[model samples]
Target: MRRPYFDLIATGAKTIEVRVGYAKICKVAVGDSLRFTSSDGSLFTRITAVKEYKSFDEMLDAEDNTGIGEAGMTRDQLLAACRDIYPPEKEALGVFALHLAPLPE
Candidate 1:
């Protein structure tokens, strides 16, 4: 996680976590625990739902932008941001939308 994002998650502003379908990410499932950390600190969240898509375009279309990314971000901007982090080759693998609920500490 990075700034603004990590901060959003901490404040419960972001409720969905998106990721590329890498080998490790593919193993995640509903009910699993995720620890999101940044140099500042960390927050624990539990998976409430898991959605899979063939690409970022599809994922962005199917998931809510506010929950998955910065508030007020347009889908196009979010899509571009996702691509900036993940190239087309990586996007070819797949995309996953992990619905999250902050866990009790």
Candidate 2:
């Protein structure tokens, strides 16, 4: 099977003894633009901002679990694709936050 759009990898944090990747809006780097596509083939673009995590451990946890990519979709691209496929999922979260599915690599 191919890997998903994004792969969340967890590495040990200095403060915490364990390693993990937790899902947070801040995972995406600041200044980067994310383009998402809807199920009906609509496109939406937004710039990512800096999102802070309570602790390094929490950040690691989200990264460790996040994964998406396949059929030529990067993590961001996959998210865009998923946005199109599942618009309603993110409607409640706000216009910016999207429930993107990880693409398979």
Candidate 3:
């Protein structure tokens, strides 16, 4: 994860982790736990839900931008950022919205 996104997730401001639907990621179940690591540290979160969409635009329409981006980021910026990370080839596979919640301390 990028530092900004990771920080947002760490602070409980971001709750949705977006990724391209790779085969391995598709295998992750709702109850699975994920560990996100940054230079600073690592945080644990549980997958609350898994949603699939044809494109990032479609996923953005259904998911909250606030949960996927930094404070005050516009939907267009969020969409562009997602696209920048995952190219057309990857997006063609699918988009995955992994709803996340922090594990207990």
Candidate 4:
């Protein structure tokens, strides 16, 4: 996650962790506990839900911009950002919508 997105998650403003890397994230299942670290700090989160998509665009449509909006990004910005990280060819590999919540402190 980027700093802004990480901050959003830390502040509970964002709930879904979107990943463009399908292979690694696909192995993560619901109920899995994951740790995230950022400049803000580290926190433990439990995966509440996991949805797979055929492409980032598909995931974006399914998410309805809620996650991207939370990160202060518009749909086009989000798409361009994702493309910057992972090329459009890789986008077809799919995406993971990992719904997350903070674990008990």
Per lDDT, the best of the predicted structures is 3
Give TM per candidate: 0.95, 0.24, 0.95, 0.83
Error of 2 at 51 (Å): 1.2
lDDT agreement of model 2 with the native: 0.32
The weakest ten consecutive residues by lDDT in model 3 span 1-10
lDDT of 1 by residue, 1-105 (tens): 788788888899999887888998999989999999999888899999999999998998788888977878899989998898899999898998899999977
Candidate 1's error at 61, in angstroms? 1.3
Model 1 clash tally?
0
Error of 2 at 101 (Å): 21
Which is better, 1 or 4, measured by lDDT? Answer: 1
- List, residue by residue over 4-104, the lDDT tens digit for candidate 2: 22112111111111111234443554444443333333323333334333433233334422322233444455445544544543433322222232222
Whole-model Cα lDDT of every candidate shown, in order: 0.88, 0.32, 0.92, 0.79
Mark the regions of model 4 whose C-alpha exceeds 4 Å error after superposition.
69-72
> What is the lDDT, from 0 to 100, of the residue 47 in candidate 3?
98
Q: Write the per-residue lDDT of candidate 4 for residues 1-105, one digit (tens) a residue.
A: 578777877788888887765577869999999888886578889999998888878888888576553656888887777777788777767777889888975
- lDDT (C-alpha) at residue 19 in model 4: 77
By the TM-score metric, which is better: model 1 or model 2?
A: 1
Per residue, candidate 3 scores C-alpha lDDT tens digits across 1-105 of: 789989998999999999988998889989999999998789999999999999999999999888998889999999999988999999998999999999975
